[model samples]
Target chain A: MRWKHSDYTGWGRVHRASGELARPERAAALSELTKDETAPAIGMRRSYGDACLNDNGRAIDMSRLDRVLEFDPDSGVIHVEAGAQIGHLLKTFAPKSWLPPVLPGTGFATVGGCIAMDVHGKNHHGAGSFGQHVTEITLVTPKGEQIVTPKKHPELFKATIGGLGQTGPILSARFPLLKAKGDVMVVTERRVADWESFIGLLDTSEATYSVGWIDATARGAALGRGILEEAETGGGLVKPAKRGKKIPLNAPGFALAPPVVRAFNATYWRRVPDRGRTSVKPIDDFFFPLDKIHDWNKLYGKNGFHQFQCVVPLSSVDALRAILEKIANSGLASPLAVLKRMGPGRGGYMSFPMEGYTLAVDFPNKARAEQVIRELENMTVAADGRVYLAKDALASAANIRAMYPEHDKWLSAVTKADPDRAYETDLTRRLKLRDPA
Target chain B: MTPTWIILGATSTIARAFARLVAERGENLLLAGRDMAELNRTAADCINHGAPSAEAIAFDARDMASFAPILDKATATEGAINVAVFVGSMPTQDEIDGDPALIAGTITDSFTGPAQFLTLLAPLMEDRGKGAVVGVGSVAGDRGRLGNYVYGASKAGFHTYLSGLRNRLGRSGVHVVTVKPGTVDTAMTWGMDGLPFLAQPDKIASDIMRAVDKKKNVIYTPFIWWPVMTVIKSIPEAIFKKLKI
Candidate 1:
């Protein structure tokens, strides 16, 4: 395997890593590479923070190893390389009435990434986290490869899922696909007047998939105002999604200035009528709306951006509202803010899901924006909520440890799996997750 | 009737991309490669993509004995039988210079092996009288450069062989496409830097499919390589020998 020196960053682009990357095209090559020296495995690098970054270290790029190894139509079980993209799987299987049980905000997030983060989707209220549906995982450590299942190696399986890839490189996985009506989605979009109604709508939602687009710049009476989208799979004929357009150059810093973001959010909120409207859309359009604008992160300009995401318990709705109000008052939030309801279902000790409301907001990498995110992180910890490691870039190590009560359990399992810390990444090191301090 | 595509070196990036394209068009696929595990995964991927049927067959470009079973499997199926050759090996010029004996293996892998296999399959394809054979060569074959002359010479030989095969196969209504691709983003060129006009495997696969549909005898992928190679070929040999590319 040839190791290429490369400089890469996460999806947010705020944190960067200059490292040596080895991309093996076959499973045998991947096994051979990991047989002696193990490195952190990265797929598509879709995480918003440093989860996929390994500064001055070696990382194995698993993108080339993506391929469906086997599929049983009768049981809907699929054995696939860890690098397979969630969107590609949905596109290939939706036509046959099958879909991945959980899809993150972007289709580009690989199955391995989803498992590593235990990501949830709009259907989290029903389908649970991504790792919940995994039947088995093949993990490659420095020693060799081992097949891990929930029943055979329950603790190892839990540690591998949402374990921040500290255990080892996930080689492949077996998971059952969800049955879908068709490739298209019937979506209903409605406007929420304020924070109260938005939370009410989310709580009362009965749809299989539901999510809210929050207007973070709104204040006073319009605080937390946004659009609520509920969708279900339906058989229909629709035009194929257009090829994504690329953002050729970085925008000027003024592109996402507060005034501009407020204006854009106002217009976006107004796009949905007050009474709401229903439409038919390609599944991708509804799930990954931002993906249509390729490299949309460039809009944040050269310095890059950060996404602050956290989930709070149902009883902490007041704390969540206080956090939203703080964000609106700061006027530093980008237009890319989201609100969703999550279930208690989770597959790992480190998995970041609970029965609550989750909020995510993007901010350009500025001193003021970072300050606001820090404040938000403190508020989340005080509310007994956990900030998503996948999107966090500035949370304190102590705060992170305090949020996940079972951190010690995960650390012990990870230590047993990778005693030498061969799979340690920038995030794990920065957070001191394995230090046991 | 749906055609059955016999893809040699199916584990290769370009061949896998081509298999996916044809599979999506509802063709049957016989993925031939040395690594049965990798080839089986690719076959399953093709089936998932929409192929009516897909199977992996063991094949080694350097082993003549491994070629017959693939042809037999292809002939067993009715209707048109297509074959796409994407088998070739290139060790760095420095490695080849260290061990001159490497030249023989390179020649067999890139040129003579596929040539002999095609020579054996030609009669069967002519009898069927309906098929296309895609032989992927390289732009390096146009002119020997300071960097990789041995690999270039092998591809040059393959280009000449395909040209003659095209002449013989066209008479029986079987089209032959000689593909000369420039640098591609595959495992072979993963770490190499400063590669000009680097094309993706999907784009090359699509170009190959278009050439087959149009029955083009010789073509350069990404189109720009044709002009680029033309200028390089026009350069006098003395100047070329002194300069490094």
Candidate 2:
């Protein structure tokens, strides 16, 4: 394997890493590369932080190794390479009435990334996290390749999930796919007046997939006002998606400034009538709404942005409201803010999901915004909640350990799997996740 | 009838992408390469994508024995049998300068070996009177200069061989496309500096598919390379030899 000197950044582009990267195009190559080299494996770099980074070190780029190895149409179980993107699976199988059981906000997230993050989807209330559906995984460590299943090696399975690629490099995985009604989605968009109504709507939503888009710029009476979009798989013929659009270049800093964001949010909120509206869309349009515009992160400008996502218990909804209120007052939030209800479903020791409400908001990387995110992290911990590691670019090490009580277990498992600290990434080191509690 | 594609040097990134494209179109694939493990993975990937049948066969440009299995695999399938040649070797100019013996291996891997194999397979394609052969040559072959003239000469030989094959095959209703690609982002040019018009492997793969569909005899990928190479070729030998590009 040839190592290329590459400077890479995560999706948010907030943090950067310069390293030597070896991109293996096949599983055999990956196995051979891992046998001697000690490096973390990264997929797509969809995580908004350094979880995918290794500064001044060696790392493996797993994107080229993406491939679907096997699929059972009847059983709806597919075995895919770790680098395979979930979007590819949806595009291939949605027409066949099967889809990944869980999908993150972006279709570009690789299967390996989804596993490493143990990502949840809009249907977290129904399907749990991505790893819950994974039947088995082939993890390639410096020692050798080990195939672990949920039943065969539950502890290692749990550790590898949301383990941030520390357990080992994931080679391939077998996971059950969900049965879709059709290739299109019947989506209902309703306007929520405030935080109460948004939470009420989410709490009462019966749809298989539900998510709320919050107008983080709104304050006082209008605080938390946004649209609740609920969707269900429906059958019908629609024109296939047009060629995806590109963002072209990074916008100026003023593009997502307070006034522009407020105006955009107001117009976006009124897109649906007070009486509510329903429409049919291709599955991708509803699931990965931002994906139509490729590299939308460039909208945040060159410095990049930070996404602060946290989940608080159901009883702590009021604390969550206070956090949103703080964000509203700051006037630093961007147009992309989301709120969702999660069931008590998780697959890993360090998994982020809980039986609570999860709020995700983006802010342009600036001093005030960084301060607000730190304060928000404090409030989240006070509410006995945890933040999503995939979207966090800023969080103190102590705060992270306090948030994830099972961190020690995950740490022990990772240490055992990679005793030489072969797979430590920027996030793990920053959070002191590899060190004993 | 389903079209069957035989891919040479299937372990390369561009060849893998090309095989996947043909696989997605519901064609059959026979991946020929030196590494069986890598080839098998790609074959499985193609099969899973949509290929009616996908199999991996051993192939080594330096070994004559490896060529017959590929030919047999192509003949085993019915209907139009398309073949794409993505075989070549590029040892750095400095390495070649140090070891003169490297020249023969380079010629065999890039020009003579594939030319010989295709010469044997040409009769079968003629008898069938259908199919296409995509011979991937490089824009470096346009003119031998300071950087990598040894590899350039080998590709130049392959280009001439492809032109003659195209002339011969056109009479039998078989198409031959000689694809001259600029610096593509592959293992070969992974960390190379000063690469102009660097193209992705998938983009090159799609370009080859489009060229084959259009039955174009000779084309340059990214399209810009045609003009760029034209200008480079037009430079006078007196000055071109002095300036290192």
Candidate 3:
């Protein structure tokens, strides 16, 4: 067994075992790693934090192994290597004007990694999570690495989905894809004043395929409440542009000030009419616009950035209000804050989806900013919600433990899967995603 | 006469690109990470990009005691650690699952180990009269999150250490830059979700280098994160302990 860890952060930032790192494209890379007494599936480096690192044990970077093994246009089902990134797959289907029912903000993430996190998206209010769309997962378990699907091993299946790679290495996944209405999305952005209005807006809309918000300036009344957006692609009304037409590469890390982002938000809002019509085109504009840029993440500049996302119930809308007020009153205007209404959810131990509204905020590394985040986490917990671990860069173990009460069960399950604790990554070690299963 | 940079965590997707970016502008470099073989591979890659002499060093961020030896060997040729950057750490994503001590160890390795290493190297730079040490700190240190407080605390301590060092060493000719990269696409937040403006490591590394050169004390990768964080911090605990984000 061999290990190699590489991320999109850059080639030099990646880690690899000189002795290992087989071209997974030739064969299943994760299979080689799982062969080790302890190994976990490796996906593309789109994860926001350290949940994928297997450390010295073994890591199977799935990037090279990425391939669409099979796709059923009729049933909207596809099976791909655990390493296949969403973007690669999108290219294959979006041209035919089809897309994954649910997707994370980052398109570079792998399907297997998405399921492991049970990723939720802007359309979560209408769609459940990534796990909901997943019909089966081909996993490499300690029990001789069998192909376990929801029907085959329901317990392991549920555990594996949103299991944080603790249950086993997912070799491949089967999911139901959706036909894109068109390649473009008809999105409308409406500004909100407070959490109540944001929640109220969600109650009214959000069934429109996609939903999001930007907590810009995080200012007074509009603190947590910023820009509320709802979008849906046209029903095949517009055609997608050429797939091969490459978008220009990303520019350097210039600062995104409140004025700039706020202007962007304002312009975006202006461009978007006030909920007068229903229309759409090009999934790129709607689903993963920034993805078109090679190094889009650079907008944050070099100091880098951290993204914190969490889900809280509609019942806790008041708590949401508190978050917004605090941010605004803090005088630390956020450039972006998003709000979304969610639908029925599938419960996974480490998954971030639940019945309610999810809010995602991006803050630069400011000493005072962290204080606001701590306060936000406490409020989210009090509201009976948990922080999204995948997007989190700085969550505390105690908070994670408390938020995910089933954490112990997940740990025990991981322990049982590999008693020697052979499979351990930086993420597992950090979040204690190490299930003592 | 371009300055050559060698990063131990080179080949870390971000680090590799960063090395190349710097080297491309005529800076010579030696990129190194876990894979010594891959380290050389990245070095050769930089050479292709315009780095006159990009190379690799086999060093580990986890081992505290061994850093000095590695630095000793490294400085033997380089003379001093000019722009030393570290992005390697056992990033904790899961909650404390099994042993408390084990979790502590992760924090110790991620935080204390780096802190101690910096402590060891600080004087060296001060004596030499010019150097920079940049670290990636997390917003998790602000207070504590319901999801990852321990890791956050460790970063907090690390940030503090950098702060203290920055204050003390500024006059001594050694510049300590603490970079608070928000959410980045590294191996750190695997399986986590709903990232807004999540950063990429290469950009982060580049940003850190720019900040180091510009002599910025603390940098929030994305500047907006700064004001955003300020608002989050100003939240009074009375209400802070209760609201959900």
Candidate 4:
């Protein structure tokens, strides 16, 4: 197989790498490539950081090998190649009253990416992380093709999920599908007046899917003000969605300026009536709202942006508030900000979920914003919270070690799987995850 | 009546995408290819995607013995039997230059072998009095160039054969779509440099589906290839030979 010399970046575009990449379309081809030259496998590059990048080295692009291997309607179990997109599965199976057990904010996240990060969804509080539903995984290492399951190789399975492709290149995975009523979502949107109401609404909500869009720019009395959305799968016929529009090019520097973002957030928060409103939408609209506008990241311009996502424990709400206050006063926050409540359901040693409230806020890749993000990370550590590796382009190795208590276990397992450090990616090297302090 | 598509080279990226599209429409499938294991995996995928029934059968372009079993199975299926030929081989120009004997194998895989199998299957479609045959050719066939001329020539021959086949089958209610994709991002063109407007395999498959739906005689995928190929074909041979593109 021939490798193409190319430059690639994660969804955040804050970090980039120039490397030789090979995209194999068949399982056999993938095996051969990995055997010849051990390298990390990448899919969709949806992780908003350097986790998927390997600078000055070789990597394998797994997107071309996407295919469904098996499905049993009786048991609602399906096997799929690692590169298959979550959205594609939802699109194909939703009409048949089936859906993936867990879906991240973006449906474009590939199965491999979901497993590597052990991603969560709005329904995480109820459904757990993506890896919890996985029955088995086919990993292609330099050694050979190894089929490991939760039962057959529990240690390896845990290490592989949230292991960030250090164990091997995930070729395929089998997971149980969640049954759904239909392909549309019935969503209830309500206005959260302040931080207290926002957390209150999330605490009391019984819906299967819930998420909050926090306005990081809101200050003082309106701090933490946002829109809370709760949704459940429902059956109904609605008008077909118009073709989604695309962002043709990067917007000017002032497009996401502070004043404009503040005004936009206020308008968006009030779009629902004072009493709140309920509406029906196609499943994709609810699950991957930003996907409709392809390359919407360009809205931040060529410099790109950084997403700082951290989860703080329930008892540490004050620390979380302090972090938000820092962000609000910094004036570096962008329009894209999200807050969610997570349950104590995680699959792997390094999985990000915890019984806490998680906040993810995006900022333009400016020096001041990076400094603010560093301060937030420190506060999170002080609060005994953890920052998500999938969204971190800026975090110190010491801080990350403090965040993930199971670092020793993950490090040992990954070392045994890849002793040569062949699969180490940009994120791993920068954070020194594979080595002891 | 549901169409049962017999896809040659079932494991090819474009073929796999096409099978999914047909499966979503609740069609039946008989996937034929050399790699039975790979083909079987795709067959199962098609079934899960929504095909009424799907089975994998062994097929070898160089071996004629594999043809009869596939023909018999497709004939037994109770529906309009459509055939899509995505079977072709392209060795690098340098490799062919090194071993002239490789030329014969290339021609057999790209032209004579698929044409022979299609010739046998034509009668079944003619007897049924309704079906479609999608022959995947390439824009490289439009004019012989410095790179991959032998493979291009074979496709050119296949294109002519498809034209004649279309003329013969049109009266019998069978439609034929000749697809000439410029540069599809498949295993075949994975790392080739200087490829313009390289389209994904799914995009090319969707274009083929649209052409087959409209019963178009000939098409260039991405539509832009139509004008681009026109310019390439119209270029003066003497000057074109000196200019490396």
| Top DockQ hit | 1
Model 4 achieves a DockQ score of 0.78
Stretches of candidate 3 exceeding 4 Å from the true structure: A1-23, A28-30, A54-57, A142-144, A179-183, A189-194, A222-226, A235-254, A258-268, A271-279, A331-334, A435-437, B1-245
lDDT, candidate 4, A191-218, per-residue tens? 8889989988888999999999998999
Which residue runs does candidate 2 get wrong by more than 4 Å?
A: none
Per-residue CA lDDT of candidate 2, range B144-204, in tens?
A: 9788999999999999999999999999999999999999988788778778889999999
Per-model chain B TM-scores are 0.98, 0.98, 0.85, 0.98
Residue B180 in model 4: lDDT: 97
Runs of candidate 4 exceeding 4 Å displacement = B238-242
Over A123-142, each residue of candidate 3 has an lDDT whose tens digit, in order, gives: 77777788878877776754
Instruction: Please state the CAPRI-style docking class of candidate 3.
Output: incorrect
Best of the two (1, 4) by lDDT: 1
C-alpha local distance difference test of each model: 0.93, 0.92, 0.65, 0.92
Q: Candidate 1: fnat, from 0 to 1?
A: 0.76
**Candidate 2 local distance difference test against the native:** 0.92
Output the better candidate (1/2) by DockQ: 1
Fnat of each prediction, in sequence: 0.76, 0.61, 0.00, 0.70
Error of 2 at A265 (Å): 0.8
TM of chain B vs. native, candidate 3: 0.85
Roughly what TM-score does model 2 have, to 2 decimal places?
0.98
Checking candidate 1 for backbone clashes, the offending pairs are: none
Worst 10 contiguous positions by lDDT, candidate 1 chain A: A138-147
